[model samples]
Target: MKIDTVKGGAYALTCTEACTVQAIRADAAFITILEADTAGQYSFVAPGEAVEVSDENAMVTQVLKPAALGVTGRSGIQSGGDVVLRNLMAEAAAFSGIVNANGGIHVPLAAGAETDTASVNRAYAMGMAQLVLMHQTRTYWLTSSCTATNGVTINHAAPGCYCEVLLGANGGTSLTLPTTGTVSGGDYSKILGYSIPFRHNGGAAGTWIKVSMLIGAGGEWTESLDAGMDGYRFRPVSGSAPSIARLVEVTLYYHEGYKSRVRELIGVGKPPGYVVRTTESSLNYDSNTNPCSAAYRLVITQSEISYTSELGAVVWLVMGGASGDTVVKLADIRGWDTYHTSVSPTLYLDVQAGEYGGRVHLESPTILNGIGNNTYVRYGLEPYQRSWITAEAEVPYKEPEQPSAS
Candidate 1:
């Protein structure tokens, strides 16, 4: 049978007796097949798609009688198939399919605000099922750039299950997930490996980082950095501050019955034909300014680079001064909001006639520095740009089965 459906509509099919469904097909996407009742009832979301259901064996029965005698054949036997036996087999198959599709379990939401001690209805993960639960407990909607830490706790975590945390920040600041637990009564040592670090790369609001941790049967945790936007490297933490991850969204996946290895949760790669161009401009400095007293300022001329967004970039600095007078230190490369005392150059370009040029890599851009004497400085930069990976949660629909009479 074929059914025409409209967008955002729910459809259901019911049968008095058990029947075998050969196949189900849809023309459009977002089609979710759900079992609404255990008594031969099924439902699905069409999402404005055309759906077709084919049932070759549809509970048909035909009886054969003796020619001479008026004795009827066996009560449950039929020409097409054994009526009672076929019904039982078909129903069993349908139930199996439902259980597999719904991840072998259903968890109802619990009371109380979501926090480190939040709990949900208990359920088992049987067969080769993968149950995923998503929650957003600590989230910050910032009007300005600031550093903050956030975390969530998952109680009664199933063995072999894992959790993923999506973190995002603004204002070219750092967002870190520490190895030590920051949440009260929370033990991060259960998670294996060191801390996870994520640099926003000084981009706009949407850039995010993904951190994944697998829970062992003994409650030991194995951690991995799934993916990050471009310009942000994923590596072990080296004495960084506690997690400044401004926004936190956690997803828990139960892989108790899963036999195979867990795959990477997120995909990260750049598009084709992507390139970075170098932007060069001359620095302006006042000669009357005391070299020992005041610092010389350098501003990026690129219109695409904004102070409010996209802060970090790669810069090439070249300065000309007397033998003893040369550029000595970099004060603040991250604009006026944050300051860095002295930073070493990533790569040295040239050093001649009291002239020095080097590649200065900064986490935040719009360079400001202090020079030794009256000098000329020229700068170049490869603006910050990156490809983002967006993480999404997919949950199956399930309805509680009604209790049968005693």
Candidate 2:
């Protein structure tokens, strides 16, 4: 029987019927027959009784638990330009398709620039259950007719390092420089700057290396490297005009890592049909704010269910994305707020994402329909963008009845 019995303590129960008193929570305590049944009380026993309190209330059975999955080899894949990633698993498997994925991605590819800022290039989520981690970007200032040589002191005086200057030259042009260098007290000598493994101090500071490369008459050079003393700057080798193909821009993407064979998440790879995430428009809803109707919406909406331990309402935004695609897509979801949000007595947040978009779901709590919010949430609508975000709680998650024999 269920009673507030502790390890070494006992309570009085004036039984009306004969029965065995068993600890409903076996792990909690043990019940042994205490006193003699003198005045019409037939002494009872622990677990089962001589003086009955219940007919069939006690049992001795073993319980088995699900196997534990190891969290080893679970790391994220860094992606962007020429870098596509496998699903980067977030905070464990909430269910099938949704994970608490968080990380950054670099889009090395640059978006085409428009002289008219009004014509902002439009971008879309990978679509479907595929999640959009983040959209990142940066502008560029193109230059021409610059000159630089080797042994240039960039960010430091002696031991500090310089930012990597990735260079791309137009035409049959090439750069000859040290592949590696070690700085001693602010100096590394110089060598024929074109060869790899050239030593510093020999390839050191103040030791000018000849700026040489195969350059066509109209060829130019571009680099992320800054200029320093001597010929350490990057420019035309000699007798070459800056080509039209100079430095323009770059972007990167970061993402989470996943093992397809292990965690069979249907939401990671292919488009899982329509998903309903968040809307870009700001609106006050009496019931629910439907997604706004427009073209190039770039986003779609659909639904499914998942789980969460968190009760109440939570706003899910695309924190960032990880992929090797060149173009970066940004999602602005913070322009949202909540009011009069209600939740289950006990619950967890579940997330569902698919082709339609992504949504915030609850982990099947009780009183399911009560898993909704009356507060209005919205975003600043732009000329060339659309959005989707989902609520993270669903209710009426009733515990299944114990199996019964027919």
Candidate 3:
């Protein structure tokens, strides 16, 4: 008798009469066997990856099919005594075919949440090993203490993965560099020195000397310095010689392809249409000195605006400009000498100008009376077209979704 199990659910089978079981079949390419016994009972989980099961006849067979995207199923089979079992399910040529077709290999951060030196090193090593096996390139961030003796080392010695070491702040201390030699079947070419400028909280400037080692093809280690880094001589005499300058941080980066993709996958890359905001001070502009005009006006000079918006247009809005009255004035006045008067407390300026770039300005004149000191002027970019309808509108911020480990 043949029994069918539901997909993505667990199952167990038991033989009632004295009969031999032929095989366990599944629609998925992989099945995980939990347990089996001679007492005519079998238990297993089916269909996310590939697994093998042995029957009383000692016949090895592929028991499941590759699962559909995001589908997980499990199943099992059993048999009784005095029965001749035959091959029930078709066999696959090789395991690699299934994995390749399904895109099953995904190397996430090793110890993604850990910060300690040992955990970081171990996670880096594991990630690098996985990358090496897949023949892909990636850059890993490994955090370590500035006082560590051995520092961090890459034992796998593959060219695809670059290891970047992030050293924490150390006060006037010297760090030991990795020595030159063969390690884990890989040769270390030599140690390269780098001189970088350092300063603490606007203090006097000092020089920080550091060293890094590289691994070439076939486990050969060599010294390589990235661009924009100044080379220096590394000489350590006797014990650890502490420097007068404090070390804020040290980063040893290895260059490799696919860095941007790796950064995007790890949620560190900047998303499209990114925007940043910086708040400027609030000030009160005195009434115009011209006695004949008697108009209380506020001027937002070009120097106050420092950031450029992605869109060339600049939208300005002023609130509570007139005393006691509450009126709103909105316009796309790009050039200077634009005047607006309102009896209400609100004033709005919509300037559609990228010609001035980050130097856009706003000037509002209160024709009714002198404006109050509580007035506010805000300048920002409206990504869409400039219109009076969206004067008070805003765009909401959304967080990026991370890839699922499943």
Best-fitting candidate, measured by TM-score? Answer: 1
What's the lDDT of the predicted structure labeled candidate 3?
0.23
- Per residue, candidate 3 scores C-alpha lDDT tens digits across 82-120 of 322232233434443333324344435445556575577
Q: Name model 2 segments beyond 4 Å from true.
A: 1-205, 208-228, 231-243, 247-406
Error of 2 at 241 (Å): 11
* C-alpha root-mean-square deviation, candidate 1: 27.8
What value does the lDDT take at residue 247 in candidate 2?
14
- Top lDDT: which candidate number? 3
lDDT of 1 by residue, 1-406 (tens): 5455554444444545433222234433333343222234443344444544444222212123212222222222323442222112121233223233323343344655474434322223221122111110111112122222333121212211211222322211123221211222122211111111111111112322222221111111122122222221221133322121111111111122101011111111232111112111222233332221122222211212222213222112222333232232211111111111112111001000101211111121111221221111222122221111122222221222322111
Say which prediction, candidate 1 or candidate 3, comes out ahead on lDDT.
3
Q: After superposition, how far is residue 324 of candidate 2 from its true place, in Å?
A: 29
- Whole-model alpha-carbon lDDT for candidate 1: 0.22
Clash count of each predicted structure: 1, 94, 24
Instruction: Work out the TM-score per prediction.
Output: 0.16, 0.16, 0.14
Model 3: which ten-residue window has the lowest total lDDT? 257-266
* Candidate 2 lDDT by residue in tens digits, 1-406: 4443334332234444334444443354544343322222222222322222343433312223311222111111112212233444354544544433466344343455453432332333233112211111111111121122233212211221111121111101112222112221111111100111111111111121112122112234323232211111233333343331111010010112110000000111132211112212221211121211100111101011112211112211111123222111222211111111111111101111122322111111111111122111112112223222222222221222322111
Deviation of model 2 at 168, angstroms: 32
